[model samples]
Target chain A: ELKVEQNPLFLSMQEGKNYTIYCNYSTTSDRLYWYRQDPGKSLESLFVLLSNGAVKQEGRLMASLDTKARLSTLHITAAVHDLSATYFCAVVYAGNMLTFGGGTRLMVKP
Target chain B: NAGVTQTPKFRILKIGQSMTLQCTQDMNHNYMYWYRQDPGMGLKLIYYSVGAGITDKGEVPNGYNVSRSTTEDFPLRLELAAPSQTSVYFCASSPQGLTETQYFGPGTRLLVL
Candidate 1:
């Protein structure tokens, strides 16, 4: 079975702090995706990393993937209260099915 | 355009009742999926379709049934609603396969009493 694990399941950071959320998978897969979900809301796609060392950034959020290590990370820089939400990292196997991590809940206080 | 649409944004069902959650996409995506979101667990795939007439089970398919008779529609059926089945259901679609970025619906919130 393909399993995805995420560390620091709960994070509480003050505004303007920097943090990194780690995701590790047990299998080999090249495709990884990051999504953000606010309380009571559906998921919003954050980034899609397609290759080893592939990195994508938007605003204060950036995501990177290392397929050989079967790991991915979502880095939040200079966070704000609006950035508080649950983040999920998912890996897509060769069959193209996604297995998601447990998710990391982030809270940024002002 | 409506990227992906799900019906009955919110519903409350009594135990043993049945209901179908409707999903449709206008992006002409060939791959569609049904996922259930619990409290802290991310999305758990219940069923997926590669294209019209092809359907497959996902990680959590025991309590759900799905049909994709057309390219634009994939509806999930719940035979007997239970408290364990109460969660937010999301419908997602990608252009080709699992490697593609999935566009999601607003989601349908269902609660079993």
Candidate 2:
């Protein structure tokens, strides 16, 4: 069974602060993805890290993948209230299927 | 373009009942998937289809079933629903591309009491 673990399941940070969410998986796959979900909403794709040391960023969110260590990180820079949502890191399981982490619920206070 | 659409935004049923969630996409995607989302748990893949008439199971595919008879339509069927089956279901599709990023539907909230 492939397990995906994420750190700091619940994060409460003030606006303008920075934080990084860690995702570690137990597998040999190289593909990783990040997704965001607001309350009662579907997932919104954030980033797709394709290879070792692959990094992608958008706005204040940046994601990186380390295939050698089977880990990935989602870094939030100078967060804002609009960035408050649950974030999940998923790794490619058998072939093209995805196995997701538990999720990091971020609450940014203004 | 109605990228991805799911019908019956919400439904509630008792145990032992059955329901089928409808999902369709207009982006000419060749791959489609069915997933379930619990409260704090992230999306869990239930079933996926590589193309028309081809289907496969995922991490969690015990209680649910799926069919892909057409390129644009993939429907998930829940038989003898159990309380554990209550959750928000999402359908996604991906076109053959570099990363194959999936486009998701709004979602269907199901409650099995």
Best by TM-score: 2
- lDDT for each candidate structure: 0.92, 0.92
- Candidate 1 residue lDDT tens string, B1-113: 88999998999999999999999999999999999988778898899999999999998899789999999999999988899998999999999986668899999999999
Worst 10 residues of 1 chain B by lDDT: B95-104
Q: Cα deviation in Å at residue A26, candidate 2?
A: 0.8
Docking quality band of candidate 1, CAPRI definitions: medium
| Tens-digit lDDT track of model 1 for A12-63 | 9999999999999998899899999998888888998889999999999999
Q: Which regions of candidate 2 deviate over 4 angstroms?
A: none
lDDT of 1 at B80: 86
Please list the residue runs of candidate 1 whose C-alpha ends up more than 4 Å from where it truly belongs after superposition.
none
Interface C-alpha RMSD per candidate, 1 decimal: 1.2, 1.9
lDDT of 2 by residue, A33-106 (tens): 89999998988888888899898989999899999999899999999999999999988967769999999999
Question: What TM-score does structure 1 among the candidates reach?
Answer: 0.96
Instruction: Give DockQ for candidates 1 onward, in order.
Output: 0.74, 0.68
The TM-score obtained for chain B of candidate 1 when compared with the true chain B: 0.97
